[model samples]
Each structure stands twice: as structure tokens, then as C-alpha cells.
Target: MPRTQDFDTAEVVGRARDLFWDKGFEATSIPDLERVTGLNRSSLYNAFTSKRGLFDAAVHDYLDRVVRPRLRILTDEPTRPDAAVRYYRSLAGALASLPDETPGRGCLLLNSAAGFAAHDDTQRSVVDAYQRELSGALTHALRAHDPDASTATLAHRTRLLTSLSVSALLLSRVNRDEAVAVANTAVEQLEEWRRT
Candidate 1:
């Protein structure tokens, strides 16, 4: 039988995820991973196959740990009509709470969209799938908010809200105020729908 591993895979992924979140993939190096995950290069290669593999694992960890929790409010049973709004507010709080050092870290996948996703087919697909997932969750929440909205109207609103959310996440790593504004715009759009 093969030898049993020593470290906790989830813990290792989480540590590597934070390092990648702070520094983009290209910027993060083998030594960096070793430093963050406490796994030397050979061990890292053995466990993850390659740096890209580790990054992929980190990305999935981010989705399960960070993004999904936020999206759960939108997709969970008995979703509140104001869930989309609450999500944006919660997102704003998350952005505000980021330490000064990495205030512009934003969403990790969104960062990939700007960096690797733009040029790498695999990365692009990952970002695209993430967008679709987010859209679906937001659509579910929007439906709860306006049960009578026409299908076309709901579709349009979902697209707009999704765009705003993507913009907010991408901007979070650069300008916190603007990121909050973009996220709030989604909330404002929903409020407008409620009024009219």
C-alpha cells in the first residue's frame, strides 16, 4: 500500500488559498507555497502534481468556503425577498473588513477572470461557470423578491445584478469605495423594482 499522507489536505488548501488570494497565481511562487503551506517543493508536487493543480484546489476551496456561504443566503430554502440586497450589504461589510494590506484582494475567482481567465481557456471556463452559478442563485432570490415579475423582466434584472456583482468583486481589489458603490447599485436596483 502507498504511504499515508501526513498533513491535512483541507488545511493545506486553505493556507495556499489565502496566499493565492493575497498574491495572484503568477506572482505566487513555489517557495511561497512552501512557506504558506509548509510543504516543500517535492512534497507539494507529489500532493498536487503541479503549482497549477494546487491553485485549482485553492480555487475550489475558496468557492466552498468563501463564495458559497455568501451565495447560500440567495439560494437557501425560503430565501428572503431582500436576500439579494442583504448579500450586497454583507459583501460591502466583507470588503470593509479586509485588512489594509490586502484591501483590494476582492473575489479570488474574479481576480482570475482579470488575470488568467482572460488568456487561459481553462481559467476562462472556471470563471464562466462561476458567473452562471452566481446568476442562478441571484435569479432565485430575485424571483422571491418579485413573484409577479415577468420572465423577461426577471431575466433582465438577473443579468444586471450579476454584472454589478462581478464589477464589485473585481473592483474590491483596487478601490474599496467604488467596489462598495457597485455592490450598493445592485441593492438600489432591487429597491427601485420594489417601488415601481
Candidate 2:
């Protein structure tokens, strides 16, 4: 008979997600995951197939637990676009506050995209899909608030704002003030779009 898995997969994935988020895909090693997940090398290999598999699982979990939930706050309450803006602003503020000693870790998906987009087809596809989903959520939220807005215009603006958010997260490492300023500008532009 096949051996039953001995650990909670979700718990393991959660730990892996944190490690990957902290160190990123390229920097994180199998030994690091094994240490973080409290799983032996053989068990991790048997369960996840490879480090990339575990990283993929961690990326999925992070999206489901962290990214999607944040997007949901906007999508679920589409009538309140300001809430979406405020939510994004708060994200920027939080990221800007992280200490310098911490490797300036950014969004795992975005970082993965920046570092691996050219070489890895899987990473590129995942990043593209994430952008599409976020843009769709923002577009849906914007339209819900202004039923008369043109679809093309709303889509363009949503893509622009989402790009700004991702850029803010990456840039916060170098210049917190500039990142916050960019976020503020995006918020202002969003506000102006609402009034139009």
C-alpha cells in the first residue's frame, strides 16, 4: 500500500509561501524549504516533486490567501471604488514601512516575473495570468461604480493602476517616498477617473 502523507499539506505550503516571499524563488533553496516546512528532503521530494513544484504551490497559496483576498475587497464591493484605492494605498504604506535589513522583499509573483520572465515560460505565464485577473477585477469594480463608463477606457485605466501598484511594491525598496508618491498619484488619477 502507498504510504500516507504524514504532514498537513496546507500548513507546509503556508510555511513555504512565507519563505519564498521572504527570499524569492531563485534565492530560496530546497534545504531552506525543508527546514521551514519541517519536512525531510525525501518527504519534500516525494510530496512536491521538486523545488519548482513547491514554489509553484507556494505562489498559488500566496495568491489565494493574500493577493486574491486583497483584490476581493475591491471586487466584492465594486460600488465603493474609493475602498479599492484606499486598500492599495494602505498596501503601499505597509510595504514602505518595512525595515531595511530585510532584503527589501517584494511581491513574490512580481519579483518572479522580473527575474524569470525572460527565461521561464511557466513564470511568465503565471505573472501574465495574475496581471490579467487583477486588471479584470479593477475593471469590473470601476464599471460597477460607473455603469456608463466605456469598457475600453475602464480596462485601460485599471491596467494602468494595477501596474502602478506592482511598480510601487518593487520600487519601495529603493525609494519609499517615491513609491508612496507614485501610489498617491495613482489614487488621484483613480479619483479623477471616478469623477469623469
Candidate 3:
């Protein structure tokens, strides 16, 4: 008979996610995961098959737990431009609240794109999918701002806004004030677009 797994997979994955988020995929090692997840090497291999597999699982869990929830806040009220503003503001707030010690722990998806995307097709695909989803959410919110706006215009603005949001996250590490300013600019632009 196959041996039953001994540890709680969810707990293990959560720990792995934190480790990956803190250190990133390229820097995080199998031993680090084993230590953080409280699993022996053999058990870790048995459960995840490989270090890459564990990282993949961790990334998926992080997106589901952290990223998707924030995106939901924007898309939830699809007809309110203020909802989009709230979404960006909330993201800025969350980044500002992170402990100073974790300075570069920006968006996990963005970090993955910078570090592992080119190295791994899977990572690249995940990042692209995330960008597309965020752009789609912003597009929906923008459409609500002006029912008469063309789909092409809304999509273009959404892509621009989403790109700005990611750039703000990166800049937050060096200058949080600038990061918040960038987000505010996006909000201001969206509001102006609504007026026109």
C-alpha cells in the first residue's frame, strides 16, 4: 500500500508561499523550502516531486490567496470608476504597510516575471495570464465609467493603467511616495477620462 502523507498540504503550501514570496523563486532553495515547510527532503520530494513543482504550487496558492482577491475588489463593482480607484489605493496601502525589512517583496507575479519568466515558459505564461486578467478587470471598470466609450479605447486604457500599477509596485521599494503618486495619477487619469 502507498504511504499516507503525514503533513497538512495546505499548511505546507502556505509556508512555501511565504518563503518564496520573501526570497523569490531563483533564490529560494529546496533546503529552504524543507525548513520552512517542516518537511524532510524525502517527504518534500514525495509530495511535490521537485523544487520547481513546489515553487509552482506556491505561486498558484499566492495568486489565489493574495492577487485574485485584490483583483476581485476592482471587478466586483463593475460599474463604478471609484471601485477601480479603491483597488489601486488598496494595493498601494498594502505595499506601504509591509514591514520595511521586506523592501523588495513587491508583487509576487511581477517579481516572478522579472526573475523567472524568461527562464521558464510556465512562469512566463502565468505572468502573461495575470496581466491579461488584470487588464480585463480594469477594462470592465472603465466601461462602467462611460457606457459610450469604445471597447478599443477602454482596453487600451486598462492596459496602460495595469502597467502603471505594476510599475508603482516596483518603485515602491525605492520611493513609496512616488509609488503612491503613480497610483494616484492613474486614478486621476481614469476620473478625467470619465469626464470627457
Highest TM-score against the true fold, candidate: 1
Model 3 segments more than 4 A misplaced: none
TM-score for each of the candidates:
0.95, 0.88, 0.92
Tens digits of lDDT, candidate 2, 125-152: 9999988888887777777656787877
Deviation (Å) of 143 in candidate 2: 1.4
For the record, the alpha-carbon RMSD of candidate 2 to the native fold, in angstroms, is 2.0
Best by lDDT: 1
How close to the true structure is residue 147 of candidate 3, measured as C-alpha lDDT? 71
Order of candidate numbers by TM-score, starting with the best: 1, 3, 2
In the range 42-109, model 3's lDDT, one tens digit per residue, is 99989999988888888889889988887887688435657787787787677667666556567777
For candidate 1, write residues 92-157 as lDDT tens digits. Answer: 887777666666777888888878778999989988999999999999999999999999999999
Please give the lDDT score at residue 135 for candidate 2. 82
Candidate 2 similarity to native, TM-score? 0.88
The 10-residue segment of model 2 with minimum total lDDT is: 77-86
